[model samples]
Target chain A: MSASVALSVEGLAFSYGGKKALDDVNFKIRSGECTLLLGPNGAGKSTLFSLITRLYDTRDGRIELCGFDVKQQTRKALANLGIVFQQTTLDMDLTVLQNLRYHAALHGMGGKFANQRIQEELERLRLYERRNEKVRQLNGGHKRRVEIARALLHKPSLLLLDEPTVGLDMPSRQAIVEYVHQLASSKQLAVLWASHLIDEVYPDDHVIVLHKGQVKANGTVDEVLKATHTGQIKDAFYSLTQGEHA
Target chain B: MNIIHFWRALWGIVGRELWRFVTQRERFISALVRPLVWLFVFAAGFRAALGLAIMPPYETYILYEVYITPGLCGMIQLFNGMQSSLSMVYDREMGSMRILLVCPLPRWFLLLSKLLAGTGVSVLQVYVFLGIAWFYDIQAPWQGYLWLLPALVLSGLMLGALGLLLSSFIKQLENFAGVMNFVIFPMFFMSTALYPLWKLKESSALLHNLAQYNPFSQAVELLRFALYAQFNQSAFIYVFVAFIAFMAVAVIGYNPSKGMMIKKAGV
Candidate 1:
C-alpha cells in the first residue's frame, strides 16, 4: 500500500537538570496506520509523547507531523494531531457537549458548523444521550469515552494517546481498546498509541518496543516476540528490557 | 487559525471556574471576608491612630477608610493571584493540567486565558468589596467609575500574570506557603497601600522611596487617581512596565518545553 508518513522524528533528546528523559529517540507513523509504542514505566514513553506533541522542545533533533515541523508551524502541526492524555482533561463541571464545543472553538470551528460537528462527534462516541450531563456525573469508562470523543471532534489526522488506560477496570479498559481499534479501522486515523501492556498491541499492528529511551524492537508482534525468543509477548518484553529482573 | 476554539475553551474554563466559585458559597463569601476584615476592622482601628496630611488623589482631608479602598482592591488581586496559582498546583496534581496543556492553541494563550478568567473573578470580588466600602461611607468620584475599569483590568492582568509566573516555578503546593509569608505579605504591606508615600517619608525616607518604587504601590496609586477621575502618567507607566515584565515572565514560565510541568516530581 502506498502511504505517507504522518509523523516523523530524528535524533530527539531531552533532559531535566542533567537527567535524561529521552535519548536519541526516533520513529515514524505512516498514514492510516495504528502503531503501538510499548515501553515500561520511565522508558521515556511519556517524554516522547511530550516532544511529539510539542510539550517539549529540543534543538538536538527534529519532529515533523504531516510534513510540518512541530517547532516552527506549531499551531498547524497541532491542528493535524489529536491527543488524549492519560490525565483526564474534561472540566467536571461542564456537560460532555460543552467540552467538545470548547475544543472545536479552540480549533477555530464555531457557529453552525461547530454545532453540527459536535452532534456528529457525540453520536460517534456513543455519547449522544449524555451530552448534557456534567462530566462529574459520568462513570470512569464514560469519562474516558468522552475524552476520546473530544479528541475526534476536529478529525485530526494523527491521534496520539499516552498510557490512556493506566488505571481502569477490566471492562472499561477492554471497551476502550475495542472502541479504539474500531475507530482506527473505520476512520483510517494514523494512531501512535503508547502503552506498557503487550496485549494492547495487536498481531498485525505495527509495534515499537522502547527500552531506556531507545527502540529495542520494531515490526509486527510476531517479529518482536521472535527476536526475544519468548512464547508470550509479556515474557518477551520483560526479557528484552528488564535485565536483572528477568 | 481559529480564535473561536481558543475563546470557547477559555469560556469553558472560565465558566467552570466561575461555577466553582459560586457553588462554594463559603469560598465566594470568604474571598470578600479577608479584605473586608482589613477594611472595616483594621482600617477603623487605625483611623484614629494615623492621620493623613493630604495626597494627590485626595483633594481634602479624607478618611482612612476611603484611602484604603484601592489598597484593599490591590490586596484582593494579590491574594487571588496566589489562589489562582495554588489552584494550578492542585490541577497539575489532579491531572487536569494535562488536559489544558494539550489544547490546540499555544500553551501561553491557554494559560493567559486562565489568568484572565482568574482576573475576572478577582475583579468581581473587588467590586463587592467596593460595595461594602460604599456602605461604610467610603467612595470614589462617581465619574471615576469609567476610568477605574481599565485600571482594574491592567492591575488584574499584572497580578494574574504574576500568579501564572509563580505557578510555573513552584513544584509543590506546600512550598507556596513560604511565598505568602515572604513575598505576598511583604509585597502588600511594604507598598503605599495603607499609608501615603509622604507619610512614609516622614517616618523614613528610604522606606518611603522603596514604597514609591514598589510596582504594586504604582498600581494602587493609578487606581486612586482613576477613581478620582484623574490621570497619573508616571504611575500608569510604572504599572504598565510591571504588567509587561510580569506578562513576559509568565509567557516564559509557561513556555511548555522548559516550564514547571516538566519539573513535576511525580505528584
Candidate 2:
C-alpha cells in the first residue's frame, strides 16, 4: 500500500485441474516504473496475467492494485487499472470511435464528456483518421493501437499489457515500447508489460524473470543480468531459463 | 460491481452483441429465415391438418393459424437461443471471448446481458414476423399488444439462458448442426408449438409428460395467454423455473476458474 507501489503480488498460485500453472509467483511494480514479465511459452505468464486482472479466481496469494485488494475491493481496484489483453479485444464490426465511445459510456461518463474523451483518445493515439474504420480493416499494429486507446478511456493509474507488442513489425513494436515508456513517465503510471520478447526491457527498468510459476530473478535489468553472470540479456535469459536448470 | 457501472457494462456488452449481429447479415438471416419458413410454408400447410381443441386462454372457436401464434413466439425464442449459442462458439474460436471474460463487471451480469440483448433482437424479429402473419389473417386480438412487453421479456430470457448454457459446452461450430437436429427440432416439435399437449399425450404417455415439462411449452402458453388479453400464472411459474435453472447452469458453465472458459482459453 505504499505510495510508490502501483501493484504488489505475493505468493500467487493457480492450477488447471490437478496441474499447476502458476506457483508461488511474487513481484511488485512501482509508480513511473515498468516491470517486464520475462518467460518463455508455458512459463505461466498468461495465467499470471489472468489472476492479476481477476479473469481467473485464485485460491492462494494476494494481489493489490493501486492499494486496493483485487478480490475484496474488486471494483475499486479494477477501476484504477487499464488492461490490454494479448488477444484482439476490439469488435471487428465496430468503428474505432464507436468502440471507444461505447467503452466510455460503460464507465457511465455522460454522453457529452464521453464524446469529448473519445475525440481526445483517438487523437492522442494518432487514430483520428481511422475513427470511422471498422476493426476488420485495420492492420495488426493499428488494431493493437485501438486496444491501447480503449484501455486508456477510463484514465487508469496502472496499465497492464499482456504482450502488447506480439506480432507487430519492428517499427510498431518500437512505437509501443516508446509509448508505454512515455505514458509511465508522464502520468507516474505503473506498468506490467508481460512478454517473452527480451528486447522490450531496458537495463534500468525493473525486470522480473518468471520460470515454471516462480520468480527466478527480479531487480533492475543490470542486477538480474549480473546475477545470471551473462554480459547480454538474451544470453543471460537463455542461460538462466534453459538447459534444465530453470 | 458498482450498480450503475454494472448496468452500464451490461449495456456495452449488449451493444457489442447487436453490432456483431448487424455486421453478420448472414447470422440475421439465419435467425429469421427458418422461423419465417415455418410460419409461412410449414404452418400454412399444416393449419388444416392440425385440429384446434379447447386451447387455454381461448374461450371460443378459433382458426388453427390463430392458435399457433404463441407457439411461434416460443419458436422464435428457441431458434434465438440456439443461434446465439452458435455465435458464442464463433466468439470462442476468434479469441474475443477472453475480452468478455476479463471485463470488470460481475460474470453473471455479463452473461445475463448477452441473453437480454439477444432476446431483444429475437423479440424485434418476432414483431416483424407477427406483422407478416397479421396481413395473412393470422393476427391475434389487438388488445394483446398491451401485455406483449413482459411476455417478450420472459420468453427472451428463457430461451437466451438456455442458449448461453448450450454455448458453454459446445466445443466447436461443427457440433452445432447436431444441436439443431437433436435438440432444437425435438424441443420445438414436442412442445405445444403446433399441437396441444393433451392431444400429443394421446399418442404417447411419455411424450405427453415431456411436452408438459418442456419449458418451451410454458413459454408458448404464457405468450398464448398474454396474446389473448390474459396472463397465465401456471405458465409464468414454468418460465420462472426454467429461467432460473438455465441461468444458474449458464453462469456455472462459463465461469473462468473451473468452467468452460478455461478449456476455451486454450489460447
Candidate 3:
C-alpha cells in the first residue's frame, strides 16, 4: 500500500443471516482527497461503514488503514481512522470541552497535548467560544461541529462521515460541506463521506455510486457524468442506479 | 495497545460515568431512595414480624434493619448494575455506544473498562447508602467499613457484569422493563437479601436451595461478613468466580464477530 493511501478495502463482503448486506465491495481512499460514497437508503451504506470501523467483523475480505490490516492489527489500523457517525454521538449533558476531552482520552491522548489539540480543533471549527457550554445547549449544527472537532482531535489520517448532514438546515449543510472539503485539501486527510444527496457532490470530488450492495460506478465526478452519459450528478446517479432513489 | 492508552481509556470511561452520575441528581437520589425506603419502612414494619436467631456473622441477636443492611447494600449495587446496563442499552440505541466501540482498543478491554466504571458508580452508591444507614443507627464496626470496600467492589463488579451480560441481550429500551420484572425482582427476592436461608427453608426447600445457589446471596453474605470485619471464604470464592464467569460471557456477548452485534448489525 502507498503511504498516501489511508483506507483500502478489497473483496469486502458481509451478510446478516442469509441476506447479504455488502457484496464484494472494493474501494480505496487516499490522503488529501474526499471520496463521496453516494447511495440511497438500504443500499448497504451503513453496512460498509460498520465493516470499515470494525463494528462488525470482516470475514470474506480484507480492509487496511494506513498499511495496517484492520482484522489482524485492529488497534493500529483504527488509530489512523476518525469517524463522525450518522447519529449525533455527543453526551448532551456534558460541556463541549468535556465531550472532546473524553474522546481524546479514549484515543490515548491526555494532559497538555490533548488540551492543545482540543483547543486547535475547536478554534478551527469556530466553536472555541462555546467550549464551556453543554452540548444540550448547542443547536444541531453546532453539535455537529463539536463532533467533527472531536473526531479530528486524534489527527487520524482517514475520516469517515456517515450522512452527517441528514437533518441539518441548508446553510449548516453547506458550511459542513465546504469545511470538510477545505479540511481534506489542507490537511491531507482522506475522507469517505456517505450521502444520498446528489447536490452535496462537488465537481472536483471523487464519487462512488453504490446500489444494491454493489459499486455501480467509481471515478471522478466528470468521469462518472461522462460514463453515465449525463450532464448533472443527479442524472448520473439516476442512470447508475436505474432511478431507484435520489 | 500500550498500558498508558489502556489506562487513559479506562479513566475516560470511568470519568464520563462519574460525570454523568453527578449531573443526574435524580438518578443518584432514586438509587438511594429505593434502598433507603426498604431500610426505613420495610425493615421497620417487618422487624416485629421476623424474629432473628444468632447468624454466623452476628454474635448477638440483631434488629431486622441491622440484619438486612448488607442485603440492602447488595440491593443498591444490584439496581445500580441494572441502571448502568439500562444506560448501555440507551447508549446503544442513541448511537453514543458506537463512539466507544470504535475506539482503537480491544473490545474486551473496552467492555471491561465499562464494567469497572459501572462497578465504581455502584460502589459509590453503596457507600452513600451505608452512610445513611449509619445515621439511622445501623453502624458496623469501624474496621468493618474498611473491609466492606473490597467486598463492595467485588459484589459491584459481579452484579455489574451480570447487568452487562443482560444489556447485550437487550436490543431496545422497551425490553429493559421486562428485565427488571424478570431478573432483578427474582434475584433480590429469592436470595438471602430480605430473609435468611433457614427462613426460606421453612417456607420451601426449593427456595432454600435456590437461595443457597444464588450468586446474589453469596454477594450479600460476603458483604454481611465483611461488615463485621470477618471473611466468609465460600461467599468470597462464589462472588469471585461469578464475576469471572459473567465477565467472560459479557465480553463474548459484545464481540462483533461471534455475538449480539451480528443481530444488531441488521438493525
Lowest lDDT sum, 10 consecutive residues, model 1 chain A, at: A237-246
A best-first ranking of the candidates according to their DockQ comes to 3, 2, 1
Positional deviation of residue A3's Cα in model 2 after best superposition, in angstroms: 1.8
Point out where model 1 deviates above 4 Å: A1-3, A243-246, B2-20, B256-267
- Please give the TM-score for the first chain of candidate 1: 0.93
Model 1, range B214-264, lDDT digits (tens) per residue? 888998888889888998999889888887888787777767565555556
Q: lDDT of model 3 at residue B114?
A: 90
Q: Which residue runs of candidate 3 sit more than 4 Å off their true CA positions?
A: none
lDDT of 3 by residue, B33-99 (tens): 9999999999999999999999799999999999999999999999989988999999999999999
Residue A139 alpha-carbon offset, candidate 3, angstroms: 0.6
- TM-score rank order: 3, 2, 1
RMSD score of candidate 3 (Å): 1.0
With a 3 Å backbone cut-off (N, CA, C), the pairs that clash in candidate 1 are: A105-B4, A105-B5, A106-B5, A106-B6, A108-B2
C-alpha lDDT of all candidate models, in order? 0.81, 0.81, 0.92
TM-score of each: 0.93, 0.93, 0.99
Residue by residue across B40-124, what tens digits does model 2's lDDT show?
7877898778777665688777877777777887888888878888888887677666556555666787788888889888887
What's the best-to-worst order under lDDT?
Answer: 3, 2, 1
